[model samples]
Target: MKPSPTFEERWKRLTSRARMSIPDDFPELPPAFHTRVLAHWQAQPVESWEDLLATLGGRAVWAVVAVCAIAAGFVFTDFHEARISRPELEHVITLEAWIP
Candidate 1:
């Protein structure tokens, strides 16, 4: 079987190929490239705290609504329980005859 190349041999081959591939005359970038790039980067919209708050703000409202709905449900259950415990009090609380 053919032997695999060692790390040093592979590195030497890689470096030699890279050296040979170097451009004879590498073109220079446009003037003020860094300034333009920095300007563009800075101009981008905020993607951190403001974004998190905007996203979570709606979710927070939803969470509050869900919690309130669950609480209201539990309140009804408690009302039902209280009613079941003291059946005699229904006559005083309501004008209509108790059905159940």
Candidate 2:
């Protein structure tokens, strides 16, 4: 049987294949490339129940919050809004549309 490669051997193979000379902070994609990629994704239609499910699953947090709020007998939006309004609450507020 062949001997297993050491970690250094595996890392050397990986780095050699992708020989990126740019600094880590350099952006790999251009701004126009991002726009084109976004347009491509938007143009592709969801074609199946599984696709629909996947799209819904990606937004599943709202469903989870709704279920929990229903079980607790409170309006889900109100509960979430109240949580956000609390002065002592420290949470990162993000744009939900971009939050996936």
| Models, CA RMSD each | 13.8, 22.0
Best by lDDT: 1
The clash count for each model shown is: 0, 0
Error of 2 at 71 (Å): 52
TM-score of 1: 0.35
Give TM-scores for every candidate, taking all chains together and pairing residue i with residue i.
0.35, 0.24
Candidate 1 lDDT, tens digit per residue, 1-100?
A: 9899999999999999999988899678887998898899999956899889998999999999999999999999987774444565666566465553
Clashing pairs in 1: none
Which candidate leads in TM-score? Answer: 1
Instruction: Count clashing residue pairs in model 1.
Output: 0
Which ranges of candidate 1 are over 4 A from the true structure? Answer: 1-46, 82-100
Cα lDDT for residue 80, model 2? 70
